[model samples]
Target: MSDVVLREPAHRVSPRAVPYWRLSAAIGDAIVAIAAVVAYVVVPGMPGWTIVLVLLVVAAAVAHVVLMPRIRYRVHRWEVTDTAVHTRSGWIGRESRIAPISRVQTVDSRQGALMRPFGLASITVTTASAAGPITVDCLDADTAREVVARLTAITAATEDDAT
Candidate 1:
């Protein structure tokens, strides 16, 4: 078998993605904070140390809410070339994927309820790899559509069975 090498993708996600990621992180952090508060309130006669723990949790949540989005914005990137699609994503731990055009099976785009407000979308490219589909998140909606169309056309033109 040949060795596989990874390289950085050439394009960054939409600038608007930063706010979208911030909002997403904020929502999840809010849920965690609320749960911690509720647990602290509902559990009476809790140890004093538990209060410290709750405070620590809230603090961590706040930090994640504020910092993660910016980190992710810097980390996330994607590129589509004539032969392959490359992507880099995640904040805490980075991931990179490359899918050759000949191996592409399908391309799909999605806009969730939260994404609609931000005019953001995600594109998923199914390939013949065992690692599962490659997804590019927080793209501008129109860009996502264009990417999907382009990938579809490219894959359609290929002679492979995508096996």
Candidate 2:
């Protein structure tokens, strides 16, 4: 084992926890609504836009039914402990991921047009790993900003030791 120290205080879970995909669906639902109308009006034959629309709606509904249940939307919690930043997600296959406080390279937040109505943003945490970045979506914007700031500070302090 090696010695490592924490530079900042741990963050607590947010109180306004919400579904991660609710926001995505908010946008997708709008598009689906338009598609539904188009399908109702434009389908010319027995196997046409009507069938396509039904498939799309069914697909979207099925996705929501299957995935929404597995996501622990109400239980989202994240904390920046002394040694690592821990985040938990999922409802059925509940997953927990930890990034060593020192291994964190970047933390960013993104805001979309639909997210604005919900006053939310998405956060992404990146490391040197090759699997690409991990994203945490549908966070209240302020919380997203706070996470980014905390991670950025931690990164700055440890940059010199980066390989």
For each candidate, the alpha-carbon lDDT, in order, equals: 0.90, 0.64
Can you write out model 1's per-residue Cα lDDT over 131-162, one digit (the tens) per residue? 99999998999999999989888888888788
TM-score of 1: 0.94
Q: Which ranges in model 1 have alpha carbons more than 4 Å from their true place?
A: 1-6
Error of 2 at 151 (Å): 1.8
Each model's backbone clash number: 0, 3
TM-score of each: 0.94, 0.62
Candidate 2 lDDT over residue span 17-120, tens digit each: 34435546555666776677676767666455466767778677657744663354654556764456777666656556667767677777888876676677
lDDT accuracy of residue 13 in candidate 2: 34
Task: State the displacement of the C-alpha of residue 19, model 2, in Å, after optimal TM-score superposition.
Answer: 7.8
Per-residue lDDT of 116 in model 1: 94
User: What is model 2's C-alpha RMSD?
Assistant: 6.0
Which residue runs of candidate 2 sit more than 4 Å off their true CA positions? 1-23, 30-72, 91-94
